[model samples]
Target: MSVTTTTPETTSTTQPKKRRLRTPYFQVVASLAWKDLRAEARGREMVNAMLLFSIMAVLIFSFALELDRQAQEATVGGVLWVTIAFAGTLGLGRSLAAEKDKGSLDALLLAPVERSALFYGKMIGNFLFTLAVGFLLVFLLTVLFNVNLFRPVLWLIIVLGCLGFATTGTLVASMSVHARAREMLLPILLLPVILPVIISATRASTALITELKTEDWLPWIQLLGVVDFVFLLAGFFLFDFIVEE
Candidate 1:
């Protein structure tokens, strides 16, 4: 009993431990998104490239068409989404390829965080970057081409289109990251798989900007919703396997 005396450090250790905080799934996703966003903020490389490319692409399309107001209205929808698709492909491919090439992607996968959460994190970051380009295109195209591109219906199309586009692009980029011709492989693989999103997005956007009829775009909007849901579900269930590969 006399030898049972404890040091202060030991006594402190014997006290009850504080409860650990459990992070919610949504918060985890946000953390992941924030991590990517923080890195992007520091670099400003990817967004700058995408923004410049999109602006030039829109400018080229605007001038190339040489369309009157009626023709401009009819074609602006295609130009906008096509620019987004092209710039989006480049953004997604580079973002993930850099992570994989630098070994950061492996480190992230080895983390205790869930894979679906990682997908959401990367997906949201990609979506936001793509949406930024979309917004810039809207502004420049509106001013340069004198077309109205800021309607609420078109906003909805942008939201949904970016969702499906980002999800599919992220998933495919993960698969293509290690490929030798990833630059070529990325778009070749991505465009075919995401064709539905492209079609529905273009159709709905055309209805909004060209026809100005919400009712006519409803079916295309529903199609986009279904495609986005399917892509997101696939990414959630399959990303772990892709990372493993």
Candidate 2:
């Protein structure tokens, strides 16, 4: 029998490489996302607070407004987007702050998985939560505003809008979690940055609600998609640096 000897350099390089390849990237991301979901499911605080806040906001807007068909068409979009923005902001701030408080963020940062995967995992969790809020808002708007928001295109717009919001909001929330006034700082940092998303979503949603031509609303949706892509890129590249800092 011939015996083969492994060199130290090859052993060192290949062992770490094997370890890196051992854990699939998608598995890491899914596990991280599942962690958030499991935590939220156990505590129920995050989703409860978000749903309560959203319902109250919807009720207030429904009662506060006196709008004709044309007015509702124009203003419903703004109301929906505004409520989503605020509720999503609340959710993002609380989620990250809790992680920071529990030292889970530290654990995550120290984990062997990729930083960008961490960002995406957190973002997916936030996206799902915010998407639930968005769906609820749609139904509430349909009933309260007497406007039909049940269209597929409108739902698509909502998905894109929430994706963009989650992408940017995740990055900003991570940045602000270390701040003393994170509650205040998150909105300040996030709102201005996601203005493009809000504006596009609002306009596209309004156009769709009003039964405007495809050309009118399609461009806004496209713009929202582009914004989501850009934010995703920014977060993917910058999360590593931000978490490092």
In candidate 1, stretches whose alpha carbon ends up further than 4 angstroms from where it belongs are 1-24
lDDT for 10 (candidate 1): 47
What's the lDDT for residue 230 in model 1?
A: 96
lDDT of 2 by residue, 138-220 (tens): 99999999998999999999999999999999999999889898888999999999999999999999999888899999999
Per-residue lDDT tens digits for candidate 1, residues 1-245, read: 36787657644457787875655778889998898899899998889889988988987887788889888887888888899999998798787888888898888887767888888889999999998988888899899889888888788889999999999999998898888899999988999998899899998988877776668889999999999999999999999888776
lDDT of each: 0.88, 0.91
Kindly give the number of clashing pairs for every candidate: 0, 0
TM-score of 1: 0.88
Worst 10 residues of 2 by lDDT: 12-21
For model 2 the TM-score comes to: 0.90
lDDT value, residue 36 of candidate 1: 87
Q: Estimate each model's TM-score.
A: 0.88, 0.90
